[model samples]
Target: MQMTKRSLPRATPEQVGIVAKQVIAFLDDVRKHESELHSFMLLRHGQVAAEGWWAPYTPELPHMLFSLSKSFTSTAIGMAVHEGIITLDDTVVSFFPDDLPGDVSEHLAAMQIRHLLMMGTGHDQDTMDALIAAEDGNWVRAFLELPVPHEPGTHFLYNTGATYMLSAILQKVSGRTLIDYLTPRLFEPLCIENPTWDICPRGINTGGFGLNVTTEDIAKFGQLYLQKGLWNGVRIIDEEWVNEATSKQISNGDGGDSDWAQGYGYQFWRCRHEIYRGDGAFGQFCIVMPEQDAVIAITAGTGDMQVILNSVWDHLLPGFLPDPVVTDESSVALSEYLAKLQLEVPQLRSESMLEAQVSGKRYEIEQDQMEQAPFPLKDFCIEFDTDSARLTLKLECEDSIILGREHWLSESTITIEGKDTRIAGSFTWKSEAELVLTLQAIETPFRVTLEVHFIDDAVTIHSRYNVGWDKVNTVHGRAVD
Candidate 1:
């Protein structure tokens, strides 16, 4: 089912307003907070309470879920456990005996299914990527053959490979693919129709990541976990297992204080707000706040995922509650804000003023910096459309892209439909020559608004997405007149 609106049951108006205001305020700050860095999709209490689509992104589109797929894999395991097919204590070696390494150490032999769930696999030297890339006939078998550098319970590593091994183990014990096993038990029950997950060359689901889905589907998964695996009065997953899986099982030394300090659970991260989330590369997130009885689902594309987490912990957590008493003032504000949220293609404003700026003029984009060095592509180009308000760009060794026009002087907007994505943004020439661009991706929960500073022959671009500006991907482009 699509992201259909679900009615609020027994709630005062004020509580709703708080959520609305926060969301609106959050969206309005796309540039100050570096919205360009990610693709964010946020859902509130089963309604499109507040939504925005940024440039370089759009709604009605799909995004890569990266490692977030592991959470779903873990959920499948929970279902299987309740059915008596396998127990968390089951041994990894039990699945494929012949695949074991030549010398199985005491530590490796002692590894249990729970170890995989906790990512405390006790294999220090081996990584999930390396394990999967092994030339062995079977990826799981390759993982099984790796040496156990330490005891399972003694260490914790962020291993997507361990998650893959879990999916393989489930298939072995249940005689069914993860998608097949979870279809009726999870997807159907939750009404997440036709969801897709990637498969390896070996025909196994890429357990760690590679899940692609709509933002609404992610919300449903969050709702399931928030409700403790119960859907519309049907108990699909055991309540006990839900509790155990979400609770902290291991301390991921890698994550720092506050939200990060809480620890890690079975394929989940324990955040500071007493909440648990399934997060993926960039910023794909399924955040469930049990105390708030609320779920916020987000699909993102960013370099540093923690900024997204920090925003949730710092901005969204404190305001949530299991059942909020509504207030009229808050509800009115929320309704107004909801009514205010709109995504439309703006009218084009002829670049008459820019005509003088452009006529036979040479331009250049200076001070291009990247948070992390962008590999493969060392240069880029930016060309402008005077009438349509468009910018055609080409990356030296990357993808081709186009930004469509903002139809009118009053309409300050840009629609970016690229080789791989559809993103739109609003633009305003706040100054005589400087242009302010606002981008909101309908596919994500975040926004990126950039201020383009014009110079004699150069433009300086800078933006932030509610976090530190240390990680910036800036580039300089010279107009080849």
Candidate 2:
């Protein structure tokens, strides 16, 4: 299928029955609290009302979807079912007889494609570790060998392995990897170009995770489902499948006020106030609200996902008016605010009293100093030129120089945590004796901050990640020459 260029129409929030002031409030709330938010897009009536990306993260780059990939995998299975290539009731073992264990247990035999779709695999815990660690590297055979502790359809376990099994089954039946299979059908129709998914050792797509898509691509997905599988007046997926896939398939937990506790569909989670979402770890969300005819896509690295949803409920949900509201002063203000939205660079005075002492100085780290650091530290040097400043980091044998500037300066290559990555960094002096360096990995949603403190002839280094790790790594070094 030939791909066509498609773009969602743009609109002012008030033009689509949304309050611009409330949307601004929502963005402000997120800015104040959710420091790790990467990008966000809000669409109403098939038109983009607001969209913004935090600096260092842009709309063009494909952000890691994590578990949000499950929803896409589920959509593929739905399409396969529509085409009669497979059925929901098909026994999983039936597809891979050669890989099955010698004697399949009753629970394993009873498991069906539908069970995997709904995360109802009878396993009590996640099975990914075992699948990944399989000595022969045959994930299918490894999955089949594991014993099912409970009946397939009766248990509710958030299992990525189950989704992987679904992807494997799809490949076996269709003879195409999930990415290739969906390219012409789902991706091309939506204009999601050059999409990528991680593959297992056996060449199957990692169904439950490892999808990379832009925030707008994510919005298109949610909008597709909200439109009941129709895009630009064409039926991409069967309407019946969309309904079944988005509706509750299993009772994940007691229907609590928490969106997560509401229920589970086919790789989708039922949310509060009649909404459903596909979310990934650390906060990648594609939220669909049917009653309001709206979709929200967000990419973030925040620890508290609930706070994001709550802000939406409080700020955006109520702003959805029944009819378009008149353009007011607030609407104009919102447009300007959205235009100027940015993740500010850390502010610090340019000059430092210790600049002369640390300039062109090499420090040798003590052996005991390496214990507290994330990476083995051998030695480091700081240098400042008229145009830029740099810190040459020596970890064991590998050496990398991180550039620092008053503004964010993009570096094409830098090594962090032993991986070569493209990063943007800026330097600021917290005090005459302390220099702070902030480095953001452009491809991933993480930033590393290093604080270099000059105390007499000794230099102390402190390092921490913006999200994920809790503890700070510290190392001490003294001038070697």
Candidate 3:
């Protein structure tokens, strides 16, 4: 019973409406928060229950999954365990003999695979070793060398380094990379494709974070976990493993609040109503409600993960169980709201769709190459693509220079020198007339706008890269022709 594209169930128009009204309200309130909450998508059962994207975002774009990646890593470990390739009781030191510290204490010595899975790894700061020791490339050994203060089961510390060690152990016993190991058994079954995972210096997928995937794909994963790893009729993750991984094994959050909110199990977070979720740093979440038979996936650029959850609980939770399955007034409003969700992709608005020639599109770019020491080719021409209107500059052959391997362990930047400077990636255009690109380069995301104005003989392109104030770039094509 493999799920085909056609076989997936669509939410009934009634169900769709209920979900839509809530989404619209949630999004409206979040915008006022004035946060960097970039994108969001929601799923129920196995279908795209609801979806929406705001300015400077779209559904096709890929976003960083951050530490929500640990769930994926843990899933890989589960697969290996099912195949009998590794046992949870296997010691950490057993996987990487070359990196174990000489004076490892009895508690550290007693640490087993399950401890890492549960985030009970004894380290003062999870990333201290990797950052201070410069072990970004060789994270596994760097993590294993850290001090383990607590007895394996005595305490719980949210340590990502522990998860990285688990990834290493899986590679050690299974002899296959994380992506390769899960591709056939898990990824393909879910119909998720072309996922990009950033590799560490040692070439292992960063088990804690750095997995990039679509919002929809993560939703499918939540649904898979919700169904107890049963896709269609086939069980990919053993039922026992799914239960153990999601069951509360430790309490998290220093608030020391109720056990329901603070509990964690095998790389998953426990929420209200026995719900557990896979959550990432900047608001990527896959909340699987097994009892309710619902899964909610979200990908956002905001810093507030809890607020997102609070919103979910406040809005969507109520719709989960409608006692008599009411069928009229409330349902119609929800449907109408969902049907109104539009991408708002503006048309080119320019009179004709013809390629408007590039000869008149050349502009002298007085480029500013940041403060990191100007290397080469600071001067260039800005060339516009006449047919597509995508701004690109053809770099002279001599301008093509090489820079050595860049490290992301710290602030890493790459400077490309070209005779014709290209408009920044964020200084983008979807259509000729409607040009707005938002770049998340630093602390706050900045949007660059190019408003096409018809002045006498030409179409002048004015841009506001910093202030809303405009600076004319150049004019192109005949006024009428």
Candidate 4:
């Protein structure tokens, strides 16, 4: 079954009982804090109230939803339980006898599928790193061998490996991958097309992360939950499952008025204001507000996720009234503002005298120096042109990326996180001797900025990510030929 159109019906903010000016305030707050949001969508009463995507980040492209993927993993598990293929009381070891450790402890043996869904697997720390580093690349074995000190359902750790185990269990019982399992029941019903989920070395979907879908897809998922698992008057999942999946299942100890403190459900974080959300690292959110009859979906590359929610509560929350208010003036202002939304491009300060001298120079970086780079770049060369510049980076082979002198240029084959996605870049002269190249991964909340300083016959390159573990990496190179 194919969906007629992959979008919900559109309605003015006032038509959906939302004040346009308040939405403007929410957007203004985002800009004031310089939050790098790629897209935003607001849905009220099953209609789209507002939607926008920053330039170069189109609505059609899929954005990576790190742990937000866990929510979908949870949905699949709930479906499996509903079909009687699996049960919440099923022991984790029961599904994987072949992968069990030599000596399963009492705590490990006691772990249940429910514990994995609520992230109460009795693990002391996140098992993600250890699973990825397993020598034999057997993540299931690695996870099973880990020590479970606390009794199942007693400890509350945000364990991602536990979610992966849920995926493994579903696959074992259903004989299908997570994506395949959800296709007929979820994606097709919602008209979410061509979504991608990265897999482990063993071909299991990385259940806790690596799912990519459009902003609309996220909003639809939230709406499905808001409607108690009903889509177009058809029951996609049991209403009982939706209630159990979204209700607080455990205390996360993240106390305070903070959203994280509200508690945790099945792969969903309960937020302040009686809301529950599925969120990913770097600000991918599927926020469902049942009381207000609304859903807010967002994708961003911001360091502070709390501030974004604060914007929603402080500005947008009060505007959701029970009846429509006069919003003609504010609605026009918002329309004008949303149409003009675009990410600022780097501007060239001035013409550089050194540009001609280094136009076609190749720089050879040593292995020790290259180690500092985020990408395994062996060498690099820059070729200047009248209107654009070509950056040649040697990875497995030479990859050329173009940067428009005045605007952002796009290259579709740039590999990021083992996936080929489009990248938009622009170059600017920081100074006569310094040049900066900014590359944005169009489908993700990530950008890499390279600052190259030319001095004598050597060049120093500093690479930085807008949001990541390491802030900066530096490498030195000598001019070659």
TM-score of each: 0.70, 0.90, 0.71, 0.97
lDDT of each: 0.63, 0.85, 0.60, 0.89
Note the residue pairs that clash in candidate 4.
none
Looking at model 2, the pairs that clash are: none
> How would you encode candidate 4's per-residue C-alpha lDDT over 276-305 as one tens digit per residue?
999999999999999999999999999999
Q: Tens digit of lDDT per residue, candidate 2, span 1-481? A: 1213666788888788998889989988887885478888999998898888877677788888989999999999999999999999999999999998989999999999999998888988888988999998899998889989999988899989889999999999999999999999999889997788889888999998988888989999999998999887889989999899989999988877688888899999999898999999888999999999999999988788898998999999989999999989998888788677655666787778778879988888888777554545677787876546877777645554556566677754666555556777778888889988887776666777888898888899888877778888888899988
Tell me the RMSD of model 4 versus the true structure.
Answer: 1.8
Between the candidate structures 2 and 4, which one is better when assessed by TM-score? 4
TM-score of 2: 0.90
Clashes of each: 43, 0, 4, 0
Candidate 1 per-residue C-alpha lDDT over 329-401 given as tens digits, one digit per residue, 9 for 90 to 100: 5556655654444444333332426535643443444434432232112333334554434433323323333
Stretches of candidate 1 off by over 4 Å are 1-19, 25-31, 35-52, 55-59, 254-256, 321-481
Candidate 3 lDDT over 311-359, as tens digits, reads 7777777655542243566456645654444223223332232224422
Candidate of highest lDDT = 4
- lDDT measured at residue 280 in model 3 versus the true structure, 0 to 100: 81
TM-score between candidate 3 and the true structure: 0.71
Worst 10 residues of 2 by lDDT: 1-10
Find the 10 residues in a row with the least total lDDT in model 1.
Answer: 370-379
